[model samples]
Target: MGSLIDRVGIVTGSGRGIGKAIAEAMLHEGAKVVISDMNEELVKQTADELKQKGGQVLGLVCNVTVTESIEKMVETVVNSWGRIDILVNNAGITRDALFMRMTEEQWQAVIDTNLSSAFKVTKPVVKVMSKQREGRIINIASTSGVHGNFGQANYAAAKAGLVGFTKTIALEYASRNITCNAVAPGFIDTAMTQALSQDVVTKILDKVPLGRMGTPDDIAKAVLFFAGPGAYVTGQVLEVNGGLYT
Candidate 1:
């Protein structure tokens, strides 16, 4: 519930889905938000739509897998906003296959997109945030990372890596007053999940004690907490999963 007036934030992969929800929530809190995605059209479209929320918005095309692309995105944000106050590493993908059937390409693709991108994106942001001595970093993780999933070895491993990375960042940046945390969402009804077969979706939802899937807003609110009033919290993994795991 803390006001983020004048704060500047960046939500990567924020053209749609949970990432877009996070950007909207930050805008609602009065933060200037940069919506970054690999898709130029989608990012521009989302930025235009979010302007109705009455906050400054910037749309940037960024391929998270490439270091040069990430550097440019960070440069643009800093040039426009002066400093970055919040960063949400929400760019991720899933290449699912049983371990026995998983290919090297699939494994590396998920790792590079989901796990490696964090290191690439955050490296430059950390420099600016450290100089300012104030910042928030929230990684979008998944329950599959916390509790292994059936056909998502690559995804689960990448998310699990995020959990560790979050802690390490918190420890490293504590002295500089930067907080790092992870939000592990469970069975959120995103376009990704909606694409699953009905039976598969039903089985996943059956495990949720809430008896329904979580919404993008559910995940967004959690990100907001860490960015705002939850500033004292660091090195924590908050499961926004409605009794699914806890």
Candidate 2:
């Protein structure tokens, strides 16, 4: 994909799962990538592996909930590379519990990780993007944001907020060449989902007409579309479910 040739990118929570896949895909497309995660060791290992494959890669620890961490990560990217072209806000957490029994900390933790983190990272990128007047941003949302799930009020609210945030950013940057959009994934086979009870997976599968869960690659490819081909597409939420909602 020469379209993304020589582009620079950042993928948050890229130590593993869908984030890792997106980082890999971006590298395959000839883009230099910055992989950020809370796990310094994992990010370092993953970045090293990608580098072994001759990809331009940088790894760093970044807690998206902290503005300083976000700023440091971006600074590291600029110092290592020279610019930022694409950004994927994929870092998120889950503190699932029934609302009736959920504590304030539980609800706040999910929102902070899923939604506030987006604001933290995107804040710096926006300035850089606005200065350059060209950029691509993809926020990794979830199906829960669209169709609420049981015991995921916080996650759902955060994901839905991402959709709204994306739309607003798109409008704000429309005059420039920047595009902001969201990719809402459903039932992806990641570490987190794999840990779910088999019965839970089965119950979820029953709702999906596609008869199978999505893969990290599925989400990665969608991210690639937004970062490259979907330049004209912005302020939209592309649900990457296996026909779960439809």
Candidate 3:
């Protein structure tokens, strides 16, 4: 049996990228996973693809920004699995702009989608987890949140807020045996970063002592450590960058 055999996990915004990689890692460890995304087609496609690999999986449409949607998601998972053992708040979007060029809409959208969504989803999930007195909550943060990035004022603020939220939630739930932590990735080779021009990417890589961009799997490995049976760590941010930001 896998390490997480019989465990039930839900990963939001898991249709693709780092989120999807996290879900896949958990599945390999013997956990049943719910793959959630706002895009219906993406959810279905990812769910089906993962299931084909012999993992127990479910796909759900979840808009983490909406409280009602989050509540329903928690309810559905609880009803199906009888308990939730893990929650990953991985759904987020980027609205890149300098402070002067950034619109109120851009700021609000990023905050709501990145920071607020974690709160909405975690609130209901925490109720069940608190009762069981056993759970893991991992938030996907970014290095941009740690060190301010160019043309990413909104994204940085939202992700930085997530780090604070992670700490508070960890402190509040520690007594309940639910640990919360954040994984801050830097210059991962995701679709978003791949779109950058070579010159831009080159400049970004020059700062990294390792001289390479991290992969989704690199971030996934860090998350799996937190989810594992041996991790006593919580309320901390693990930087998955290749020595880019200290």
Candidate 4:
């Protein structure tokens, strides 16, 4: 039997990229997953695709920056599945600029989506999990958060905030049998990194001893460890960085 057979999970920003990979991994392990994203069409498409693979999937349109939208999604999930066994706070965006050049809007946007959304989404989910006495929460953080990046002050701050949030949740909710952890992915080959100039990409790759960009599946594998076999683990940030020490 799969490790997460019959479990219900929510993966935010799951319409594509790393978030999609996490959802796919959970579904492969027999979890009923919720494909939550702001893009309605993408959500529907991804859910349909996963369902075709025999996954028990639900598609929900969620604006992670809006608490009302978040609450509605949580309500719908609970109404359909009766309980939430896992949540992956994977919704994030990068507004790349040096600190001096970054605007308030860019910083606020990243902070709201990446860090504050976790606070909003987890509150209600935690209430549900507290009653069930078990749940797993994995936040998608970044290596930029750990070591900082030149053009990602806003993104790095938000992710660093997420790392703190994960640890705090882990400590506060352990008594309720809920585990919270953060997965810090480094240089994953997603559309985000693909947007970079070749010169920048080559410079970044030169720092990696592995000499290659990490794939979304590499991050997914680390997430799966927390969701499945790593039951005794919590409050930790696992860096899946392809041996690239910043």
Candidate 5:
């Protein structure tokens, strides 16, 4: 049997990209997973695909930034599965701009979606996990947050905030057997990166010792380690950056 046998996991923004990869990894390990995203069609499509792979899946539309939507999603998950063993805060967006050129709206939008959404979603999930005395929370962060990229002021701040949130949750919930950690991915070859010009991609990748962009599965593997029942680590930030120091 897989390590996560019957664990119930909620992966936000799981319709595609890294989020979808993480959800797929958990499902392959025998977890019942919730594929949640703001895009209802994408959520349904992802859930259907996973189900065809023999996974026990649920698709829910959730706007993590909204308290009402978050509460509803949490309620639905609990009603269906009776418990939540894992929560992956994988939903995020980027609004790239230099700090001087960044607007208040851009900063707030990124903060609300990437950082504050965790506060909204985790409150109720943590309550449920507390009662159960066991749970895992993995927040998807970014290397840009750590090293500070030139054109990603808002995105960087939001992800950096997420890292802080992860550590605080870890400290506060350790006694409850709930582990919270962050996974900071570096130069991942996702849809976002694919949009960059080859020159830009090459320039970014040249700094990596491995000389290649990381894959979604690379991030998923790290997440799986944290999500596994046997993990004894918490309050840590694991950088899955193909030997890239920055």
Candidate 6:
């Protein structure tokens, strides 16, 4: 759909993984994307590769945990494009450990990156969006957050918090034409999951009814549903799992 044609959108952690997939999907449907990530080298590489496809993209170095970092990043985009239409809070990290063994720093880091980072970036973007009275904000959460898992206290907590935040913001801005939603993904083949042993991966999938892991494209498509579908869907969590939670 060219509904997003020539529009400016930003996806965090876009150097790779699901974030990259979302940006690519938007571009396929005709949207100019700003790739945001903390990794400068990876950002440039992804930007260059997308440009190879004739995608209009810009690399933005951002650390979502820091207010100034997000401030400067948003300012740069507004200065360049003059309008920010959609934002996907896909940047996150994990420090999996038992509750008894989890360090304060580990817990704090996960919360900052996964949860607070959404706030830090969304606050500014929402201001601009509210002014226009139309916008899309999609936050990437996890199935692990919905159904808590062992050794992932921090990750689960932060992701669950994001779902709550999404719902609240959606309600607060319902009349302003600003839609906020969350996408909870199950297993996806990415660098993070690849780090797990084959046995662990298999064990995890054994519980899924679909008998297979999901892909980044699976999550990306769900995100696109919220981005340009032009429906009044909001404050909802679309679980892109293999029917695991069902």
Residue 27 of model 2 has an lDDT of: 94
Model 5 quality (TM-score): 0.98
Per-residue lDDT of candidate 1, residues 93-155 (tens digit) = 888899999999999999999999999999999999999999999999998899989899999
Q: Name the 10 consecutive residues with the lowest summed lDDT in model 5.
A: 189-198
- Runs off by more than 4 Å, candidate 3: none
Best by lDDT: 5
The Cα RMSD in angstroms, rounded to one decimal, for candidate 1 relative to the true structure is: 1.2
* lDDT string, candidate 3, 86-138, tens digits: 99999988877789999999999999999999989999999999999999999
Count of residue pairs whose backbone atoms collide, per candidate? 0, 0, 0, 0, 0, 0
User: lDDT tens digits, residues 1-246, model 4?
Assistant: 889999999999999999999999999999999999999999999999999999999999999989999999999999999999999999999889888898999999999989999999999999999999999999999999999989898899899999999999999999988999999999999988899999999999999988899998999999999998457999999999988768
lDDT of 6 by residue, 1-246 (tens): 476887789999999999999999999989989999999998999999999999999898998899999999999998988888899999988888899999999999999999999999999999999998888999999998899988889999999999999999999988989999999999888887888889989888988899998989999999988998476799999999999882
Error of 4 at 224 (Å): 0.7
**Candidate 5 structure quality by residue, lDDT tens digits, 121-169:** 9999999999999999999999888888988999988899999999999
Off by over 4 Å in 5: none
lDDT of 2 by residue, 1-246 (tens): 456888999999999999999999999999999988999898999999999999988889999999998999888888888789999999988888888988999999998999999988999988888888889999999999999999898889999999999999999997989999999999999987987899989999999998999999999999999999446898999999989993
lDDT of 5 at 115: 95
Clashes of 4: 0
lDDT minimum window of 10 residues, candidate 6 = 1-10
**lDDT at residue 171 of model 1 (Cα atoms):** 99
The predicted structure with the larger lDDT, 1 or 6, is 1
Per-model RMSD to reference: 1.2, 1.1, 1.1, 0.9, 0.8, 1.1
